[model samples]
Every structure is written in structure tokens, then in C-alpha cells.
Target: MKKTVHVVGAVIENDAQQILCAQRSPSMSLANLWEFPGGKIEAGETPQQALKREIMEELDCVIDVGDKVEDTTYEYENVIVRLETYKAKITEGAPIAKEHAQLIWKKRIELPALEWAAADIPAVEQLTK
Candidate 1:
């Protein structure tokens, strides 16, 4: 049986209206693909709490998690991921790529142009709508 991993993601938008995207590092399971910048939800943490914690740990920044944008399950070859995404705004510090290969801010229309992680595609589609 495939392990189901519950993860939380953030669609962090800046004042310029561009969404923050991160590239998974080479050592990650899904390396080099773009994602909405978050991580697996730790046990006992709410989605919001997980999002806040993941952003802090991954980007060295604080964020205020907003409404949930997507909640869907996607199966990778090795695991099934339930990715829950929420709209977020940075509240402190700058986003520094601590665990990712890179970070980019792009407009919604440009989101589809990049190769995104399979799990993040649905939220990207909804954002572009």
C-alpha cells in the first residue's frame, strides 16, 4: 500500500501580485520541479500551522496563512500526497531559499509555462482561473 502523506502548501502572493514558486532541491524526491512552497504536515499540526511552520523553515520568513485554495490527492510513483494549499501573505523577513534550488515570483498566467510538481498543478489552474 502506498503511504498517504498530508502536506500543506502556500500560494504566497506579493504586492506585485506574483505568486511565489520554489524549485525542489536536487536531493528531494521530486527534484527540480516547481512547487507552491510548503512541506508535509507534521502530526497534530493544523494545515494552517503546518503552512506557517513550513514557510518559516523553508524560506526563513513568516507568513499569515489565508483561505485554503485547494485540497487534492495526487499519487507519485512512491507515495500518495494530499496537498492542501492556502492563500498566504508574508508577514516578516524575506523569502530565502533554504531547502529549495531556487525561488521565483511569477504572474498567474506564467504559472502554466513552468514545469510544476504534479500535486501543485490543480492549485495553479485554479489560481489562473
Candidate 2:
């Protein structure tokens, strides 16, 4: 059986109405694809909690997590991913791409122009609507 990984993604929007997107590093599984910045849910953590921790680790910023955005389950070659995304705002510090190859803020309408990871596509659609 393929392992199912539970992960959380933060769809962080700034006051400018732009969304933050992260590019997967070359060493990462989905290299060069864009995604919301977040990581796997650890034991004893809620989805919100996981997102906060992940944003701090991956982007070096603190965020105020808000409503659930999208929930998707996607099956890849070796694993199944259950991705839970939430609306968020950076409460402190600017985002610095600590783990990802790059980070950029894009308008909702422009989001589709980038190639996104499969698991993140649903949330991207939801935000674009």
C-alpha cells in the first residue's frame, strides 16, 4: 500500500491582494513546481498548528491561519497526499524562501500561469474563483 501523507498548505494573502507561492527546490520531490508554503502534519498537531509551524520553518515567517480553503486527496506514483489548505496572513516578518527554491506573490488571476504541483491545483482553483 502506498503511504498516505497528511499535509497542510497556507494560502497566504497580503494586503496587496496578492497570494504567496513557493517553488519546490531542485532536491524536492516535485522540483520546480509552485505550491503554497507548508509541510506535513506532525503527531498531536491540528491542521492549523501544522500550518503555522510549517510556515515558520519553510518561509521564516509567522502567520495567522484562517478558514479552510480546500481539501484534496491526490495519488502520486509512490504516495497518496491528503492536502489541506487554509487561508492565512503573515502577522510578522517577511517571507524568506528557506527551503524552497523561490517565493513570489501573484495575483489570483495570474496564478494559473505558473505550473503548480498536482496536490495544490485544487486550492489554486478555489482561490482563483
Candidate 3:
């Protein structure tokens, strides 16, 4: 039986209409791909809680989770991920690339220039619309 991982992602936008994207660490599974800042859902944690914790751990910032936006499921060669995505607003601390290689804030229209993760492509398409 294949194990499914429940992940949480945040579609965070700033006042300048730029969305936050993080480059996966070169040592990570999906290296160099741009993705919404998030991580796996831990045991006993809600999706929102996991999102907040993951963002803080990965970016060294605090964020307030907003409305639930969308959920998507994608299958990788080794495992399936059910990603629950949500809108989030920064409440404190400037974001730092603690886990990722780099970070960028991009206009929604310009997202095509960055190479995004295959699972994240659908979410980006939905956001661009």
C-alpha cells in the first residue's frame, strides 16, 4: 500500500500584488523548483496549524492563516500528496530562507518565468485566473 502525505500550502500575497515563492533546496527531493511555502502535515495537527508551523520553520517568519482556498491531490512516483492550500497574511518577522535556497516575490502575471513544481502548477494556474 502506498502512503499518502497530507501537506499544506499558503498562497500569500503582499500589498504590492506580489506572491511569495520559495526555491526548493538543492538537497531536497524537488530541487530548484518554485513552490508555495509549506510542508507536510504532522500527526495531530490541523491543516492550518501545519501551514503556520511549516512556514515559520522554513522561512523564519510568523503568518496568520486566512481563508481556506483550495485542495489538490497529486501523485508522485513514491507517494501521493493531498495538498490543502490556503491564503495567509504575514503578521510578524521578515521572511528568511531558512530551508529553501532562495525566495522571490513575483507578480501573478509573471509567474510563468519561474520553474514551478509539477504539483504546484495547477494551483498557480488557478491563482493566475
The number of the candidate with the highest TM-score is 2
Ranking by lDDT: 2, 1, 3
lDDT of each: 0.95, 0.96, 0.88
Cα lDDT tens digits, model 2, 23-77, are 9999999899999999999999999999999999988899999999999999999
Candidate 1 Cα lDDT to native = 0.95
Worst 10 residues of 1 by lDDT: 36-45
Worst 10 residues of 2 by lDDT: 53-62
Clashing pairs in 1: none
Backbone clashes per model, in order? 0, 0, 0
Residue pairs clashing in model 2 are none
Judged by whole-model lDDT over C-alpha atoms, candidate 2 comes out at: 0.96
**What TM-score quantifies how close candidate 2 is to the native fold?**
0.99
State in Å the error of residue 20, model 2. Answer: 0.3
TM accuracy, model 3: 0.94
Residue-wise lDDT of candidate 1 within 1-129, one digit each (tens)? 999999999999999999999999999988899999999888889999999999999999999999999998999999999999999999999999999999999999999999999999999999999
